[model samples]
Target chain A: MKNIVIGRYIPGNSFLYSLDPRTKILALLILMIGVFVIDHIMHMVYAIAIIFLVLLLGKISIKRIYLGLRPLLFLLIFTFTFQIIFNRHGELLFEETLYYSPVSIALAAAIGIFWFFTKRFIKFRLLYFLMTLLAIGTVLSLTLFPGTFATGRFAVYEEGLFMALFIMLRLIIIVTLSTMLTMTTKPTDLNLGLEQILAPLKILRINAEEIAMIISISLRYIPTLLDEANKIMLAQASRGVDFEEGKMKEKVVQIVSLLVPMFIISFKRSDDLANAMEARSFAPGRPRTRLHVLTWKRLDSCVLALSFLLLVTAILSRVLL
Target chain B: MAIKFERVSFQYTSMDNKGYLALADINLSINKTGEFITLIGETGSGKSTLAQHMNALLQPTEGRVHIFGITVDDKTKKQRKIKLNPIRKQVGLVFQFPEYQLFEETVEKDIMFGPKNFGVSTEEAAKRAEKMIEVVGLDASYLKRSPFNLSGGEKKRVSIAGILAMEPEILILDEPTSGLDPIGRNALLDVFYNIHTELDKTVIIITHDMNTVYEYAKRVMVMREGVLVYDGDPVALFSKSNIDRWNLDVPDILGLTRDLEAKFDYKFTEPPRSRKALFKALEGMLK
Candidate 1:
């Protein structure tokens, strides 16, 4: 149970792993901004291509990326359905009592485009060009197609298509950039980067050390909590607690039983951890030496520079073109 | 004065909402001065449950536990009202796999935790910690190193030192040598012996290993299904025939010695606790 979640971080000397955490974080921020600035299929295509190229260089497996996407499948489907039903601005391809709108079609297209780009980012093993092309196709399909089903209901397919493309491009860029950041950075380094970034809050008498401790504890416990949840589920299953056989309310009651035990165990572990920490003289305000130091190299600088250039170009294309 | 339990009964709550009686009515006492007392029982026999009661970590559902004539509940309430700092200062407990209790990044800080928590000054805590580190036979160089990084035996020793730093009068250890290899177990036994002989601290150990009880304990307590069935000298306890009825085995050395005495038709005046003692007894008989 403990080993299951911990095995996510593959140990390797890939370029992605070697890049500074701060650089990755900054690049992620820039990409998210660039995603919002994109207004056309061409720009969306370029953004997807860049993300794919980064994933290829990172050496992360496509299977692992797909696995990451498994958790978000429901959300993706919901977004697609919501967008398709609500879009009213597009031309009606079929007539029915319930007329589909151009707006709904554009929204569905946007969702599809975002999903495709996000999936590519998750499938980090795909060839750079292939992932980029898939991302472009997603954006184009979303932007050019309106979800209207009614015929002769004042159609404006070109406007709906362009709008859908624009929205899809934005979403694709955001998801790809965020996924890339997470896939490339270690949690520990990310924590250190957070500490460095939040250091300015020290002026308000807020202790950075305490905040860092909280972050570190949260990071450490998430995997632990998941492991505990898994065990509790297994224990309940062994005791004839069929979670799948129950109605919603019954399932909730069963879940409550599992959660109660999990919470109890977590609290006990926390108390033990506290005692252990105290015994080790881990008091607030004490200066401690770090074993692993974060260093920024030339590669980090180059990545940061390229990310900024992309952001500037994205903005220029939106404003000037 | 030392730890004593008077007619104590405890009931454990099971997952199915049923009560499992852990310890039946029992009376036991230990002196303040150094003495090794071993409690032996099978799994679910209340050996561990009984040990927890010694330090007031768990209160008896019935009867009373007295530490140096002060009832544990009385002390617990008083400590809660004012603080438990004093009671905790006197009775230190080293739990099973005590190394897991280590939370400090450095060994020195971990050792100082108990002392500091009890309101000892930083300087005094450090001094006590240094003494404890030596007492546990760990090098001073370990002071700066992380506790988690230490070997299993070393981690156990560090945990023991953490308890000792508080200067507890009575030390309760639950399965101290459990999960250790033979050599590690023997080395730990030596450490316990040193604590008993040199420090004069009252020590209570919970174990099921008959040989350990026979060899080391001045007094042996046998518990069966949470009932204190026998409390007497180790030699006399081993000689009893009804032991098998209680699902208990005599120590291997004692069994061999008893068989020899039966075959030879001459009584060995003293029952041997170890191979050396058995050899010495044989030499005397031959002479």
Candidate 2:
């Protein structure tokens, strides 16, 4: 729960903290779109450079941003593997014999058995098992299949490798930059910014203020709910819910044990909170004056314009280059 | 010793990445069995942090902790074979509002959950659960009911039964009766008393209730701002010249005894710890 970085605002006085919340959100959106539009490798590097600049200017600890990415490690690996395996472009890197004889098959089988046992007993079973499977695939390609050790038969494409790296870098940068925005910006300011940005949507007869309020309320509750969930988990852990020590099957039970109580607690809290809010005369959809109306400054405008200019440059590079 | 803390200190990094010291240079030890200990402190006095160390839930940031002679230090963390379940099994912690831990479909299954996790066979675990239900004063009929459907006090009892089913040698409760009504509080305390006296288990309670400290604790350990300020018998703790300096409350009966002695010529031989003992002294005075 402590590791959950989304919606968590760290108090700071960096340049990024001074920017209007709407500008930050808009800039991030543009920057994310810019990352996808860039086709060349050098352009990707330029995009990464821009992200690093934002990260540096934010003044948040890089270690904290890295910790926030920890939960996505498995997803990142999975997606990278999927892109590498399915992609078949650019030059072939190598080829080798994967299966040559019955004896070699038996050796591979022994290795597979070893891998299976290790996966079953290890701490990070999913990650270890996936990597082991990939290793076995590579070894099988090397020994079981009849081919030269270094030629183009069974191979890895350069484009596949580059695309995987590109995807992963894009994901990490986008997540980190967005997280940095929330880390530096307070929730009330973020809500006001969101309200200001979406106020134009009112012309379409859409109630944008309500949407921003909902988003802010939910964001405000995320850490509180996460805290409650952590308490429940610890309480259950003391009862011998070995979350870290269990087999895959036991993990399912452990998750249910955690989730059910959290569900009950969250629902109970929401009901109580609703009653408390109603008692205090808080009615939804009412015209409410903000305590801190967001005032846009020169820095916010400069940052927003620079982000837009960067987005245009990225699009031009993709098209004209 | 069941547990020992040697120059233990804990530093916590909250979500905001600010570090705060929760416990500082704490040294303490507990007997293996038949010791009823109460930990009294103001909030943030590290009572919970110290209890967590007893079962290796949280290792000390500095120095070492030994739970039943098994060292839980930084060096042992690298050795995966040194499992914490053994310590956790022996030192059962019933957290405050332990009822929140209940998640099994039935009360019986919830009680059986802890023993099952410790690798007890289903049949044996179920049997222990039945025995624990009786031990906690819950009826056999409650075994089939959903734990969530039970009343607040019943849920607390069932959750406590879950820990008792593990048959820990030392039972540690953190504010066991905080939100319960008077009858419920006494009922739960009676269950703990039975476990301590009849079963000969070591019971450690973290509480702010001075009355509970006076009536039940054989020894009281007091903490003030992450330091152990007092450790001795309850009588000695209450009678200290500067007991109020630590912001501790004396038990009502003990306080009343002192006030009565101040106003009258008759002298009470010694301050009694409980209401019944005070009343008995008064009866003797009338005779």
- Choose the strongest candidate by lDDT: 2
Local accuracy of candidate 1 as per-residue lDDT tens digits, A184-245: 66767777887776778889988876897898898799867885675555333322245445
The reply for model 2, stretches above 4 Å from the true place, is A1-11, A34-151, A154-180, A202-206, A312-321, B119-131
Model 1 misses residue B231 by how many Å? 1.2
Each model's total of backbone clashes = 20, 10
Estimated TM-score per prediction?
0.47, 0.82
True contacts kept of 1: 0.00
Can you give the lDDT of residue B227 in candidate 2?
86
For A51-162, candidate 2 gives per-residue lDDT tens digits of 7777777777878787778778888888888877778899877545455455545566777799877775789766777777766666666543454334324456899888
Interface RMSD of 1: 15.5
Name the regions of candidate 1 deviating beyond 4 angstroms: A1-321, B14-16, B73-83, B262-265
Tell the DockQ for candidate 2. Answer: 0.50
Chain A TM-score for predicted structure 1: 0.71
TM match of model 1 to true structure: 0.47
> Best-fitting candidate, measured by TM-score?
2
Clashes of 1: 20
